[model samples]
Target chain A: MSGPAVVFDKVSLELGGTRILDNVSFRIESGALHCIVGANGGGKTSLIRSLLGQMPHSGQIRLEGESLGPVGYVPQVLDFDRNVPMTVRDVMALLTQRKPAFLGSSREHRAGVDAALKRMGVLEKELRPFGGLSGGERQRVLFAQALEPAPSLLILDEPCANIDEPGARIVEDVVLELNAKGVTVVWINHDWDQVRKLAHSVTGINRKVMFHGVPSEVLTWAEPKAMVS
Target chain B: MNTIYESIRLTLQGLAANGTLPQAFTYQFVINALLCTLLIGPLLGALGTMIVVKRMAFFSQAVGNAALTGVAIGILLGESYTSPYISMFSFCILFGIALKYTQYRTNLSNDSLIGVFLSISLAFGASLLLYVSAKINTHVMESVLFGSILAVDYTDMNILLVVTLIASLVVLPLYNQMLLASLNPSLAHARGIRVRLLEYVFVVLVTIVTVACLKIIGAVLVEALLLIPAAAARNISRTLGGFVAGSVIIATLSCILGVLMPMQLGLPVPTGGAIVLVAALVFVVTTVMRTTLSRFRATGV
Candidate 1:
């Protein structure tokens, strides 16, 4: 039930003659809720992209696991056209199955898609056009898709970027619940309070590994006032 | 395949003799044209959904324009006018790949790239048409620019049939992945789908279908057949299944009526223009209906 420990060895990435990430190295303990904290344009997404093999970077990123398990990813932003005519259920089928979406989502065989939506509180919106959903609702749908099949390693980039507060809380709960179940959660979190309160460890990146430590040790520089209170 | 076409033609002839169908169906060319529409309709309709959703309308239209240059180049290269398969196939495929490759290599937007490609192809087709007009008859030029129902034969029916089958087999099963790839290449790549490879496969599919369709839809108006049906379907449908099914039905009907109406009314319209006009009519009707329904819903009427 446990997941793999990820290792980054001297990772460096340069895009269009500009260095994005330079010689960054760190290790994320398997089965821990590890949060990545960084400012805007700090290459957090790029690092995760490298881990998912989306970018060509000079690095030896290894997942140390007995059996390499499935990796689930929820992107930071999904630009869906307003009139493309796809339902949330249709999108789940699109993301999760190789079955043609034109065949429609089979309720009998796709209990999992419904279940994940229920977990994210978007089950009622399953039949609605994906584009019509509010910003927070769309984020919930993305989280639902990533959680199904109970991935061994989940990579979330700003999962709560534009969501409302209550919606953000629901997503945060899911991440914590998933981590407690022994899934490796590599989350790029913009909200510092959630990371400070819940993350087992934190890694700060500003084109490099600026800091990597437990939440207690990391918050001294991020917010000394929060640490005092 | 020819036996199948022959048998269908005979059956239609029997139906026409028995007064079950119009007398126009008695002609082998009418039967041939209808058969071509039968296959081309569903193929373009279904692929059009993907093309429309991917925002590849311009790219596909550019390919249709390229088909003109392909045809002219085929004629100048001494290829026959009836079925210039090789020159047309190679040129369109090459044009499609090069356009896709340049999109990846250059900083220019896809529309700008397609715009430039379309302009060059149109210019090439214009001059080539003039050059070949002296050698081939002006009548043949009309057929090439627009579609000619009379020129369709059993060979075209067979080629269209094969492409339709191949396209259906490839597209129907992997439709989800293809949709995802176009929507979000990074997500598709993360899900272990080869995005770049799928792009090429899609380009090739569009090329073959575009070339195969040149006989009936013609170069100028083929993109209309591809876009109109799918656009109409999207205007009303709210789910993927409905969208695809609606597009296929509208497209099939448009193709059938496009070919038959011109013949029955004794109009001298080209088959390509006829098809587009019919499809555009459907699009207009559906759009009005959708707007009215939405307004009614807004007022709780």
Candidate 2:
């Protein structure tokens, strides 16, 4: 339980005949906030997918400490039809309860869902259709869902995108709180200022790991223009 | 089969004697049609919720249309015209798998892929039908296309019942996982759910349901039963439980009304068309209700 939480060694990915990532490598320390930053189409998402084991990649990704437990994920955007008649409560129930949703959620799970919703400040909208929520509200709901069945490692892909300022602050605070609880967090962010303020370590990735170090050092490190491009 | 039918007939006859239903309800064909609808309605309603939520309406429709080509191929292969289930099941399952696999492998939009499959299947069916016309009575094809509930025999009813039971068993337990996958595939995958595998499983289920329903609802109109009731329920439901239950209620009610209305009115309309029209009417009613409710809430009246 002492080594790095995750280690990626020479990871590479080829999708649809395009080389999306090449020889990317980095180490994420346990119980730390690690952020990935890059330009558009820079393979940040592909990297996250690889880490989540959603896509195939050529690499050695080792979970160094305890065996990887349930990994909570909050995707950047809600990728469902807006008109679907699913309530926030249903979403929470689906994630937390093992029983079929049609059978009605168990009382314990319902209370847990309510507590999680309350934590994310969307408790009032629990009974409302997920499609009816505003973008910010939906983001908050996503956060609430991910926090349930607490994970040892949390992966967020651009958690603040498309959210309002206050909503963004709530996300920032939540991440900080989770990190303080000794949970490892891997976040993908485009905002360098937020990365500097929040991340304990930063990895600049452009197809490969351009730099990986403390935020200040990585920021000042000279990156080859050709490699970045 | 005869025993089951006789038991149902006796029950219906008792009801008729008690002055509950029309005397015609004791007819074997009418009783079979009612039983078919009673089983298929809730099954379609439950599966249709996922179909609509996953935006797979076109995919299911394509599967339905492919049933015609399956039947035509069955007839070409010398299978019985009345019960060409072997080719029907084989062709539709393969068609659904091929479409799903192609969509997974290629970058094409689902709608475009479905359109391609739908056009090809329809063309194949038309060509094969021309060949089949000389071999069998044209009325056979007509009944397959428009659906004559009177044509549902013991075997078809048994198939429908088995499909309903099997579908409920497999789909009910995995319902939440399927919903999570449809809503956010990457998240579902991250949680160790095999998203692609679940998707294929769902497509296969839809194919099975579409094929099993072809004789009662017809290939041409089966997609309507899978779409309209769920959509109508979505308009009035605020939660998933309510949505699925409302959908089942709407589908069952529509099927019963559709089946009984033609008998009561002595209309010559096809049962499939009648059922689809009833579902459409329900959708319209629900839409109006939702709109009126919104308006009332807006004015705080």
Candidate 3:
């Protein structure tokens, strides 16, 4: 049961005649919060997409010694179709996948959803329309939705992009907390200060993996200015 | 002049004394019309919410139009309209699967693909109708072109009910996944929500509703039944659940009022057209109310 949480070997991706990620290789150990920092269009998203099996790429990604299945995904921000009205509880209900043929969602399922929302600090707002939530609150709800399944690996892309400083700090705290509980985290962020503070390991990419190790080892003040600044 | 005035007074009295029970209650024809509305009411309302939420109103219309060829085939083969469900379901499901599989492959958007299939199917249906009219009762063409709720029988009623229940069951179980997928597909996909499958399911559900309820709504205006009420509901609600619940209420009211309109007023309107007109009216009223309320709040007068 103990192995690298994620292993990406010889991953190469080409999109529209440009190499998004060329011959990338890395292995993130279990319980490590690995921050992926790169300049815009620097293969960070592509690499994550490949990991999620969204993009067509040639690579072998393994999770816990097996082929990487669908990992839990949290996006930078949520843009929903406003026509469909939905409350936070309704969205949480979606996570239970309750079928009508069954009697109903078990108490355990409801408890799990309640617990997850509480953990994200949006329990009271569960009845609120998901559309009405602020950007940070929506991110937490999305995080709760992703975490409800207790995914073995969590993949987030630009989670703090549009939020204020306090919101970003909340997200950072949540990520660190999840990592502390032994959940593997792969995060993409433009914020180096937060990344350096929270990330146990870091990978800098510009269409390829530049470095992979402790955050201090990979992200230096000079040379990789595109990433740090 | 005195006699004419007396006649006008008599008419007004009779109209007022009709007991506020819309004219559709005046005769067996009216009763049948109401029954038609009752049968298709909740089904269309529910489907409307799903359609608006999923943004598949156009897709449903395309599938509804495509069912014309199936109906033509059923009637041509000497089978009743009841027999068309087989062909219609198969055709719609095939179209749905095609839409789902080709979604990511082509540069043309989903609606464009739907349009392509829709036009092709309509063309095929028109030719089929023409060919069949040459062999059988020409009136069959009228039924397919418009709709005939007067012809609805116990079997049709049963079909509509069954379809409604099944659709509700299917949708309720996967409501969350469907909602998430509809709202933020990329996020849903990343969260392991099986976005493609849910998309396929959404399409298939809309297709089923189209074929099942086409007898009441017809091909041309089916999308209206699926959009108008939901749109009207959206004017008042801020959340997805509210929208869906509000859509059902508005749709049900529209159905009842729509049926009542033609009967009570002797409007000579097709029932399908009446329903759509009522739904449109509801949307207008709600929109006006919303605007007025917002303006009042802004002005603080």
Worst 10 residues of 3 chain A by lDDT: A97-106
Best first by DockQ, ranked:
2, 1, 3
Over the stretch B11-76, how does candidate 1's per-residue lDDT look in tens digits? 999999999999999988888888888888888899999989877887766877787788788889
Worst 10 residues of 2 chain B by lDDT: B292-301
CA lDDT for candidate 1: 0.83
Clashing pairs for model 3 are A85-B239, A85-B240, A85-B241, A86-B239, A86-B240, A94-B176, B23-B264
Over 4 Å off in model 3, which ranges? A1-4, A14-19, A65-72, A95-129, A132-137, A147-152, A224-229, B1-36, B73-83, B295-301
TM-score of each: 0.93, 0.93, 0.83
For model 3, the docking class works out as acceptable
Per-residue lDDT, model 2, residue A41, is 93
Quote the TM-score that chain A achieves in each candidate.
0.94, 0.92, 0.86
Candidate 2 residue runs with Cα over 4 Å from true position: A1-4, A220-229, B295-301
lDDT tens digits, residues B1-301, model 3? 3354345445544664686643334454445545556656666776677676656668877887778777777777767654467777787788777776777667567677878888988899888888777767756545544666666655555677777778878887787677767666666666667877787877887778777767655766667777888888777765555566677777777777776677667799877677778889989987887678873122111
User: If both were scored by TM-score, which would come out higher, candidate 2 or candidate 3?
Assistant: 2
